[model samples]
Target: MSTAEPQSAFKVKGQGTIYLVGLGHASTHWVHAMMIFLFPYIKQDFSLTYTEVGFLSMIMHISALACNVGSGPLVDMSGRRIIFLMLSLIGTGAALFLFGIAQSFLFICLLVSMVGAANNLWHAPGIAFLSETFPKNRGYVLAVHATGANLGDAASPFVAGFLLLILTWQETSMAMSIPVFVALSIITFSLLPREKNPHASSNSKGMNLRDYGSGLANILRTPAIRNLTLVIAVRGMAQVGVVLFVPLYLVDVMMFSPEGQGTTMMLMQVGGMVASMIAGTMSDRVGRRPVVFAGVTATTVVIVAITFISNDLLFIAGVSVLGFVLFAVRPVMQGWMMDLTPRELGGSATSVMFGVQALFGASVPILGGIVADTWGLIEVFYMLAAFMLIANVLMFTLRGEDAEARA
Candidate 1:
């Protein structure tokens, strides 16, 4: 019914989608960043080794992998993405509330799993909606969405760390769930123009499992998307590795406290915010691969530099640069995928690619945990750099059409 609103010259136009969906993007990163602040507290509370803490994410991501794959086709097929988005918020928020009261290691793990499941459901649908609403400027729009994620990532650790000084980790988690209420209010009250599932109308009364599988298979048959999936997977894996262990490296290797580490994390995300905007615009001008090359190559250099740096100022600068290039690459990659996918299959493509990414990204912590357990936290960077370079190389193989698509 509200689908007709997209062309009515309404003042809000598609911004409703951007703002609400972007908030979800920010929320996704917010959970990860908040966990960094909680890590020390959780470790202390549960007597967890670093490996045990790493396993929390491992379990969460594994659960997310299933949800991510399913969310895409549903978004592609359903007329109720907003409903799905609202549900994602409710479920994740409820899980966070549970996290606040969690007493045992298993209970915390269970809550994180629920949180992960909810988190994975929003992205494909949200991005698919944005792509349909703002077809011409997807690179810029998704970049704006990525910036929301950047701001959230930047804010969460600093806020959580500051809160930890005044409150227990449980209390800080309770506080963290507050944004869910704000987001839910917006989604519930805002007049978001209902976005059509890009897949258009189907004759079937309901989606069968065969439909989901075949739809997903059809999307992946394209070479560009297949290559893109591989690139994003490695990039995602590298990013998770970096974010998961950077705090550990700062605290264990550089002897920085949680507060100091939070500062570094904030700086990195601030830099990412700037880079995401620029890279999205740059992709619309020069091409996705050029932007990809610029961001990833620089990111690789900064990541490797962080390995040896001991100076506080210099290390923070490196972290900042790493964040910039890493976050900048996301929108370009996402926009590139949009360029390659048919409008109808957009949601499915996004989900399948990101699902693979979630798979690889989720696994990084376990592997990095093993490496850190055996060697040192700093050693994790070596693997991260390698994964990033591999991802960078694959970006060269993206569809020429993606490079040509500019506003």
Candidate 2:
């Protein structure tokens, strides 16, 4: 057997591979943000209520929930990390292209659901790939990959807004699909080599339902995994609450133009993009518990502030702070999970955590929509704050030692 280095250090080759994976990660959320920016246009065109608007994201989440659970193990089963990634990239383009042509509400929802599924399924394999590729730099490298999503998130609003000024929303959607085609071309022709999965437990032949169930059951049995999974579930509730309603508030209550809403989203995501990378590196040195606890605590405080503050500037500041803190928790948690799970089961492990997140993340928008329809949009922020506070309390359940464990 080969002598592998300690968990705290990385010995990765093909540095560009990390960047490429990061780019792949970025593409998922870039499409997501583009969809978000289209919300106003959709609402106006369809004469939709807040509930209907929330339903759009809700359907996507539902599809994502199912796919996230199965896709992780499938990636492990296939043993073709790069292949799954390419498919995800291609799916992104197809979804956007479909959206560009779709006329009815039903078809729009269907396309969104497809995009959501494709977007989410990437995380499991991508996380596993990076963990194997850069074992030593796990925190920073995962953060880089996650940072790509945030960059996509941050950039899309600005790009969409700029494009909206000149083109129809459908035209803009079609144009955005162009990047995926370009990215796919590069990935297809590029000399990116696929790394072997050293931790694959099943033989290369095939996996049965029993084997898949056993792997899943094994991951769910871990105390830390169960706890962290629940923590994210609660946090995701608050996150979806914020994301699903903020645009409505901007359009209906604040009377901000589409550009203003995009700018607000841009501020929050930009904060997240920069902070996530830094937080991941910091977690490697200080520990995941401190980073997550500190982040959730700050996020809770900011949510509370956003709840009360009505001024646009103050709210933007709050969004920026919330972005920085909330975004940091995701990658750090992934790194911690990687540290504890055996390499062979990393796929199932990541899936378990991500699937829990998707289950809750998908529901919140619809639930929050009901709240917005009943109480008002402002009330949703209060609920968002409450969920974040509860998540912070849940985070304390994570152990001191687990936080410091290296992969």
Candidate 3:
């Protein structure tokens, strides 16, 4: 086995950069939360059928799916971290601004597609940066990064909801763009040092379809990577379904107002933030598999319990636990992917994982909507519980050989 050099210590400024990535993640969550807030306004304005709303979501997720693949190679080749970060934030902000002003469904679709594409640019590189910046403590650093995202998720709905109460949906969306714009400016001016692309030597000539295909094939053939992807896919499907419909469940089943729904969603984010931190640290010490298994199992249990809770307070408590279990495992999973792939293919591998998950998540919102329309929203929660249980079983099948090798 090759002996790897010891990684440098994490600097104060480096931690600042990770915080920036967290803020960026928060902005993405804000956008997502804002969308939920806008749904009613959008439906009222356009008289959108359920299918039309579903199609709009499909556009965003599909664009994210495509961009995830494209951005991987771009990040690998350039290693211009700040430039990519700035572009992503600016582009997403522009899309949101346009979305606020968009006059028609077609216009909104186009703008939202742009938002999706731009949002896709953030995760892989931001995460890759966190991984590279804190190589020695990748799991913990990534966990911190994910926690930042949870904070954003927690705040986004409340911000959007507050704006919705005072202003129109378009105005609320326009207001959401301000923080991202500020982030872009900060990134543009920040004096962060550029790090060498870990994968630079792997594809000096740049990535092509054949190269990507081969790399992807290599990833699939690797046992650990294969299992990791399966776990992500299954958990992703259930997570997306619940997240997309949970607001509706609160509104339709529990009879919460929009503001109340937003508050409930915020609670989920708070739970997630706490879980991400604790899980990330624990996984680094104890190993990724155990943390992941426990998290997923706990999540499944919470989802099933949510169906039985009739009191609003009990439901909120259950959902909060669900949030913690759902998000806590993300950083560990991401760290595991990095562990499996060589540095040279990190971006590609990350992209493949995210892209596939996004595609899977894309299907979920629409499917959950359909199920909610036919059965009850409670049925959707039960179905997710069933899926999470299956995912837990699959997770147990994962070998820790890759992680063990790292040790």
lDDT of 2 by residue, 1-407 (tens): 12344354244455677778888788878888888778878989989888888889888888888888788888766655677778888888889877889899999999989888888878877888788656666788888888998988888787887788888999999999888777777765652344343334323333566876787677678787788889878988887777667777877888877678888888888888888888888877776788888888888888777777789888878788878887877788788888877665677778877778778887777777788889998888888888988998897778766534676
In model 3, residue pairs whose N, Cα or C atoms come closer than 3 Å (at least 3 residues apart or on different chains), thus clashing, are: 199-344
Expressed as tens digits, the lDDT of each residue in 1-407 for candidate 3 is 23353333244345666676777777766666666656656866898755566677777788989999888878766554556777788788888777778888889888878877887788777776766556656677788778877887788787777667888878878888888788676666662334333232233334566766687678778887877887898898887777767876786679877677778889998999999988887776677888899999999988888898999988888888889889999888888787677665677777888888888777766776677667757788887887798898898668646644332
TM-score of each: 0.90, 0.92, 0.90
Each candidate's clash count? 1, 3, 1
lDDT of 2 at 332: 83
Rate residue 5 of model 1 by lDDT.
Answer: 19
TM-score quality measure for candidate 1: 0.90
Best to worst by lDDT, what's the order? 2, 1, 3
For model 2, where is the 10-residue window of minimal lDDT?
197-206
- Cα lDDT, all candidates: 0.76, 0.79, 0.75
**lDDT score of residue 15 within candidate 2:** 66
Worst 10-residue stretch by lDDT in candidate 1?
Answer: 1-10
